[model samples]
Target: MRVEGLKLTPVSSAGIEQNASEVASGSKNFGEFLTEALGEVNQLQNDSAKASFDLAAGKLQDVSQVTIAAEKANIAIQLTMQVRNKMIDAYQEVMRMQV
Candidate 1:
């Protein structure tokens, strides 16, 4: 399985620092951040779907790889749902507040 498109790279400190700077600088709004995060989750799901389909079609050799991809997509979706729930709770609490 020569996965040409799936190359894993080490997470460098510079990348983390840049992301932090962008958030701290307000270059990206909350909605923009949320949208990007959701887009990534969507991509994960799509990749997982492709892996699953390939597995069923016998195009994929390793079942473990498909399993891992599905799990990764599941976790991403779960995290996104949790974040959304928290945001909804915060909004409702703010609405209830007598300000």
Candidate 2:
């Protein structure tokens, strides 16, 4: 079963490096980038919740869309958690350094 308008693309390391460089070069700060990422995750979660509600209410016909939205939200949340963990680890390591 193929879902229309659903396209999966591989992420490139070069693109990630470019984005990091842009953020580091004063175009955008780390805090703003983090905020935007969190906002996107929140939006994906909201979309998944709405899709679930629609499906439960018999208003949605495509189950694949709902599944996709849920998976997107889940992956975003997992990635956010990983990043948060890494940041905490780095902070603790810095604190362990001698002055």
Candidate 3:
């Protein structure tokens, strides 16, 4: 059987390096990043709620859009919960470590 090479586009490293530098310089630390992420998740939940309200009030005709928004919010909440659980576990582990 003959095989052909699959073509792939080159990935950019400049943006990645810039983000790393920003994090390393403390201008945008972990707390700020976490806050921004949580804010985004909250926004998604608000959007989902609005979409649901609009659909119920007959302002929105697209049910799929409401479903998509709700699913996005649900996924974000699940991810945030997992991250919180992991952080708690890590904190506990550190507390248990001998100084």
Error of 1 at 16 (Å): 3.2
Clashing pairs in 3: none
Query: Which window of ten consecutive residues has the lowest lDDT sum in model 2?
Result: 3-12
lDDT of 3 at 75: 100
Q: Per-residue lDDT of 3-63 in model 3, one digit per residue for the tens?
A: 9999999999999999889878879878989999999999999999999999999999999
Error of 2 at 17 (Å): 11
Top model by TM-score, which number?
Answer: 3
Can you write out model 2's per-residue Cα lDDT over 1-99, one digit (the tens) per residue? 987896889777998899878867899878988999999999999999999999999999999999999999999999999999999999999999999
What lDDT tens digits, residue by residue, belong to model 1 across residues 1-99?
A: 775787798877998899999989999998997899999999999999999999999999999999999999999999999998999999999999996
What's the distance in Å from true for residue 8, model 2?
17
Residue range with the least summed lDDT across 10 consecutive positions in model 3: 22-31
In candidate 2, list every pair of residues with a backbone clash: none
lDDT for model 1, please.
Answer: 0.95
Q: For each candidate, what is the lDDT?
A: 0.95, 0.95, 0.98
Backbone clashes per model, in order? 0, 0, 0
